[model samples]
Target chain A: MEKIPSSEITPESVYLSRRRFVGSLGALAASALLPSGLRAADRFEELRKELTPLKSITSYNNFYEFSTQKEAVAGLSQGFRTSPWTVKVSGHVRNPATLDIDDLRKKFPQEERIYRLRCVEGWSMVIPWMGFPLASLLKIVEPTEKAKFVRFETLLDTKQMPGQGASWYSWPYVEGLRLDEAMNDLAILATGLYGNPLPPQNGAPIRLVVPWKYGFKSIKSIVKIELVGSMPISLWMRAAPNEYGFYANVNPAVDHPRWSQSSERRIGEFFRRKTLPFNGYSEQVAHLYAGMDLRRNY
Target chain B: MVWLKRAGLPILAHAGALTPLALLIWNFFHDQLTANPIQYITFRTGKTALVLLVLALACTPLNVLFGLKQAVALRKPFGLYAFLYAALHFVTFVGLDYQFDPELLKEAIFKKRYALVGFAAFLALLPLAVTSTRGWMRRLGKNWKRLHRLVYLAALLAVVHFVWLVKSDVREPLAYGAGVIVLLALRLKSVRRASAKLREKLVGKQGECRQVAVHEDLR
Candidate 1:
């Protein structure tokens, strides 16, 4: 638990770091309204920019530990051990990297970009994600052509995450995406949000942020990354394939086995809003699904 | 007769059964439904309903095995409340999640095996609730007993419904199954005792029962 300096919290540091992030794309905010603690980015901002046009900037999340309540995640994740963490990158890449947490954060510059994260269960949260592009990390791994998809696995140890001990969700969190989807600029390997290290419940150290797909696809607290040629086995999909599809694209037209997908409740908003195609990042990821009927694929 | 008074105690038990429903509604109105209100409400209501249904089904064995005659009268209200929550669960799934999409609803029921089983359990409980009133029970007469047997079936369906819906874990359904088996065992024991008592009463004048003669020899 090393203490971050008070001066390191300023917006200029965050903005300067963000500006130098992967050739800049989105707008820089006034920075005055944002709290000092909410200004810096980690190493995944470049990838997050392409997933902009976020619906709301404060609500989407996957923390279920202290409470399933979205507001409780930040408070609950304080108990996490973020240091001495390592991400094991395995499978079809030429160089298998097992990088230390701090080393991973220092590898790339940071940026502050807002992106909408729509959950598979029909809820949305817009987050001012602070990190560099995931594609940059993928570049480092040097994925071979044989790799067709990238799968992510969360730490299943209930000792670390109390929520895993409960029967609430099929615990050890797992999610994945196709190779092209993984390499898509909209995809990010996030480590921080609002200028601070990602709260534990929100996937501290590092996690996948696949903006166009459902939130679950963005596996949190990732300890393993595998590149495979076949469709990766997803926990939820294997549990109930009809309810949670393998593709799991954010499509309004597709209805879940037991629920409708036409509309979604933005986490902070009072009312529900119509769900957008690719969660409103159609311009970026929609082409990836071209020639394929979303409803059928859904 | 003391037996008559004891039999009437079931009426008292019926009043007691309403306490849980009252507390549940009170908790909901008071905003004690947890942080994620939707999940909290859904889980609480569904769980309470399942508990009540199990209790209602337990009445027969409880009355015969434990002589909990008063518990028998609680069946109707408990059964109806189970239906109420089951209906509420369905509505929340449809209203809050689906927003009244008929095509989606139909497809969800037909396409997904678990959803279909859950929906069927809901449908089975509906008839028991509709005929729960004294007037309907009287009008239906003995047919009411036959129709109410659907509860046992409903209990089985409910357990299956939960089992199918669960992705991997079997713990919850296993608990429910154990409860159902214990209750059914009590019912079986009661039924066997009643038949034995009838045989003894009918043969009392003869005093020549074969088992009795064997017991006398052993003594």
Candidate 2:
């Protein structure tokens, strides 16, 4: 599944290219990451070695109703809408694209990368997400200088999503990141998890996965990608400004007004443990915020 | 000592019976329970409170139906349990759910209908608890009986609160509501019967006095 990289690729072709790239690179990365002793698809098992535990299970949720508990998302999201899905890439892009789900899957070469997911509520989860770097997808969109940030929009219909109908939370979630953050190598366009297609609750079809930021920053069930010169509005931050901030980085020192961010409860941890800063990935992302005060930013 | 035998031991026993509750709390703090333990804690406390409340209400019937002289002992403990769980329920909703934001609390009460009913129910429970102590009961005397009557009101409000708190698929709340209605109806019927008998005695005494006065004037 060799993807022909081109400058003027059609949205349809770009979509197809992404899926091919994902499937191929995923295999390639597996072989690269694993020792030769392991066989084909055997690398997923090695990748599973890095299939780490979350810093906190409570925060690692998609808010899907199937499971009343946090760990229930895996079981509940099995029925997530995957096929016939489409992501419309519009607003400030050089070329407006309406990419079909099948084509997008074929276009991207998947790679399994382990990352930590820190929630705004002082909890964290670590997962081995399967997809290519978001940089690859952004490369196809080719944002102009005016594209200061990338905004993501989730599907909002309450008829399909019962959570939206209830007062549990607001629906049609929106999340965004600065252009630089969106293009970071850590940023991922996830299509699958734990060596399978993405669960419906985990932003099935295609979703942005920003590891360095809070879990909400990685929106699920994306239907629109907007590149804007202006700072795009974020839903959670707007909902409660003091509790939620625009830059939801994982910093143990900066406590939320309600709870201490210094510690978290891992899902299977017999004892709740003190939280690690940057969810134990400080080596990767601490440099990005080296000079800035996370407390103020938080 | 006599009062202790009558009232204080039951209260002490009720308070001591919180051992399981203490264990649950210990389980949560020690991390023996699941993460996001607040939801579990909240639900467990609520269910326990509900059961105790039903038991508290049933004490009167037990005194009448089964002739259990010690049924009064259950009232204080069960009432206190209901109060404890109600407090926990509110704490979970405010602490875990809203993160102690007064603004969010205000918004929920103002914008959300369920929140409004829930808040009202919480307020109703406050007076009933404050008037629960024997000291307060003694201090108020007759006023105490009038104030403690708030329990019935509080019970009605709680049922309403639960019923409205559920948006749809309300079979559970409806059952609770029906139970509350029947219990309250029994009390209402008994009160009406007593008042009717008292009115008849007063009227008959007045009629005899009038007849005697006429007989004296004719003689």
Candidate 3:
């Protein structure tokens, strides 16, 4: 693995030379470079402006599998076992295999991706995630032409996750993305954050990070990844179809029936800032829904 | 002892009602209000307001059912506390969250259904809070009861506001809805009549006990 000085990296340079950076740095240095206190955005100028504190990113979360209260999730999720895990990749893929978590780490080299996570509840956070691109994983699985959507599922154990016992939502939380969206470079299968293993409350072992959509769309603690011909029903969408749509892309123009999506309070800020279209990734993901009506879909 | 019972209990209730606010202040000063303090404060105050509103609504029913005269004395203080929290909740949204941006605040109230419902709930409680004093109560006379009845509507609107505000999970709001429904059901004419009958039976027993005590004292 090549060692590039952190001072040399800028947001523009990082974005322009992502593949080169990922290829050179490889697996060895990704974890070594990310000290817990170091802001992932410190080396990148654009991201530095809004990066949320590591404490907030780990502590303030909406992993309903633990609890609803943001502060309570950390303590409640302490019992979760993340190691000795395996993720099954099957369904409409040409290669169907259950790969151990350790094998996955060695298979794909880690890349550092800084992303803004916007919650549907009107708060946002900027996090530095360490992971490999979803496209890389999909390529390994060799998704067949019949696969229209990529479905993801979180582990379901009432003993491990106490919230699973509640009938408020269907257990074994699931999420999905269109095959095109899944193959997008922006979508990542993250393993760690702030240079360390994922804290249990923030989804441990492995998770998906879709930057352009609401935070809930980035399902956590993924146990299964299935390529399906039909669109998979997501946990939130199934529970409240009206509130949580399948393509929960962050669009300020498309207000939720109950609340305004026009602005969001940045986790550390006092006042709300105007929300951007596609969470400021409009140039990349907006074309995905070109002719489709966002308001109707939302 | 009589003075303490009459005055001290209400004072204690007032302190109890302010505990949420006190905790919020302490948390704010200690930097423990979490990352999104504005959102935290907004939710905290809104929840406290709703809880106090429900507690205030329960007071009249308690008086009607078991004839707890002390519960009647608590109604004004609880309602006022609810109003105080509701006002704080609104102020947090307008002053802190919106930073007093008129355009944003207008859009929130006019365009957002949850904010509109929340604003309406607060407005409904405003007149009731203002008329809580003995002077206004006497001046309004018969109209005061009719006006104060708006609390039920306010409570319903507040619950709706909460239910709509949540992105997906409705369990918390639904629980509040059930509580409000049960409280509202107790106010029905038939339920009131049944409660009156039960109240008479209990009051009759109390009267018999008082009479026996008087006879023993005379002997």
By TM-score, the best candidate is 3
lDDT of 1 at A57: 28
lDDT of 3 by residue, A1-298 (tens): 9988988666786676885566346433664565411323233335756789999998888998888889889889987898889999999988999999889989999878888899988889999898988999999889988999999999998889988887878889999999999987788999999888888998999999998999999999999999999989998988888778999999888867765688888888766889999898775577788899888886
DockQ of 3: 0.54
- Looking at model 3 chain A, report the run of 10 residues with the lowest lDDT sum: A36-45
Please identify model 2 stretches exceeding 4 Å from their true place.
A1-60, A64-78, A166-170, B1-39, B46-74, B83-219
Best by DockQ: 3
Q: Which pairs clash (backbone N, Cα, C closer than 3 Å) in model 3?
A: none
Native contact recovery (fnat) for each candidate is 0.13, 0.07, 0.73
DockQ of each: 0.13, 0.07, 0.54
* Cα lDDT of model 3 by residue, B90-188, tens digit: 999889888887877777877788889999999999999999999998999788888988999999999999998875578889899999999999877
> Of models 2 and 3, which has the larger DockQ?
3
- Residue A180 lDDT in candidate 3: 93
Order the candidate numbers by DockQ, best to worst: 3, 1, 2
Q: Is the docking of candidate 1 incorrect, acceptable, medium or high quality?
A: incorrect
Cα lDDT listed for each candidate: 0.69, 0.66, 0.85
Give DockQ: model 1. 0.13
